[model samples]
Target: MEEHGTTQPGDGTTLVPGPGSAFRRTLLRRMLPAVAAAGLGITGIAGVAHGAAGGPQRTAAADFPTWGTRWVVHADADTRSPAVGMVNASAPGKDRITADYQVDTGRRVCEGSSCSSYMAHLTGPVSGFLTVVAVAIPQDRLPGIPVQGAPPPQPGVSRQEMLARAATWLTADNGAQVSYSQAKVWKDGYRQDCSGYVSMALRLPTPGTNTVGLATDRGLTRPVPLGELKGGDLLIDATGDNNRHVVIFEKWNDAAHSSYTAFEQRGGHGTDHRSLTYGLPGGDAEFTPYRPVAFSD
Candidate 1:
């Protein structure tokens, strides 16, 4: 992973505090309403509005492609004053910004299979929202690169077969490991911990692009929601009270599906997937979406 330029405090940049900070808490309070309005159900807000100016809007079916190749989110490239700043005061002048992202698919061994890994980047400043007002784009709009190198596979490999292969690679006892205690360590070793694992799983590259984690590392700020989850998405236990961990949403089983699931890694211990369920006991899991760098039609 290559290092990107850092945003200065005076440059309208604010550092994304670790989970449990007053900053994250305040941001989440403002975002809950917007998320509810999007129809994911927050609390006091209504469901997503179904119409536009002229006629009824087309809605994607529940089984529609919840996953996308690439994803893009654009902001008021003309907005003056940062809605959420690093320090006390607001940001200055019109400083429009745009971000592009490549989602990480983790290891290919778990393709189409029921497996687990963590996704990060998506929960950062560029993608995560501080105020419900920031503009965002979904994966349906931005497509990702087609799968390359290997020729197309034979007739039919069930989701089970593909997942088995992907899992082999992911759980292999290789020495690669990540830790959250030190950001500089990850920057230096290019390895990932739970959060980095999820970020890498989505194929999110090092900074220099509109990638989520990179943007977060770059000082883009926001709070994330859990109900809006999709594959290649990030789950964060931001409160830092519960075991601080980051994981990916590989599957969403409606049958007997509790609020969360369990995640198992090669060296890491097993983690409950439902830990991300919104309005949980300890604290809610924050979520953000990312685009797949190698996703295809």
Candidate 2:
């Protein structure tokens, strides 16, 4: 097994101390699925797996090869982060993140089902150790590439006419860092892409979500009507195979559903407001929006 460093989770128990501890080895044995699969997210703290009252917790097996999963692990990880190259979950919620599994991995492919392998990265922290946040997303839909073309409805600072809290991803780094330790990715004012915008706006555990994960993640969300969309809603463009995109719903620009202003991470630009029409108006780029009850604004 590859060893680098160790981490002491909230439970005071050492995972990979000095060399390789029994717990670390055992933990690796359990996290095999994560290593074997190329696109599976952290496999921890992301799935609402078979839970018991303080019982064991588990992550779902890698299934969507064409698609993938996304998640984060909020531990003090540094350059020498020793992941046991296996699949295992020790603590009950060891692998669970607040965003469930809807995240992005910043893989830039040609869209649809490509043959490139997608792996999550651990970005350096501005202050502390690298506690990473990652996800699985399509390559073509990474960031920078607008929904259809350039200027993907990138809007400016929100007016905040009526919102519980202002949308904070308006000035992210335009998905520069594919994935990072993502400490304080939300209101901390980090540069972000479209998925990164969603990650922070929704306060997810990680900053990675592509058009694919946005449309099919089955964590704690249910589909809602576009007309019924309120704050904190998501509108994903699941049109073509590789040209999918997503946006955070602010409010309808008009009552006729003609246009609406929302927040997203654009490619040419960083985070900004986007005035959308193609997906909403319906035609080739018909979009489907979903509302997260737990994360409703």
Q: Summing lDDT over every window of 10 consecutive residues in candidate 1, give the lowest-scoring window.
A: 61-70
lDDT of 1 at 276: 42
Error of 2 at 170 (Å): 1.9
Measured by TM-score, the strongest candidate is 2
What lDDT score belongs to each candidate, Candidate 1 first? 0.28, 0.38
Residue-level error in angstroms, candidate 1, position 219? 11
RMSD to the true structure for each prediction, in A, is: 19.6, 15.3
Question: All candidates' TM-scores?
Answer: 0.29, 0.41
Q: Candidate 2's C-alpha lDDT?
A: 0.38
**Candidate 2 lDDT tens digits, 259-293:** 87776655655555667764565633567888654
TM-score of 1: 0.29
lDDT of predicted model 1: 0.28
Query: 180, model 1: CA deviation in Å?
Result: 9.3
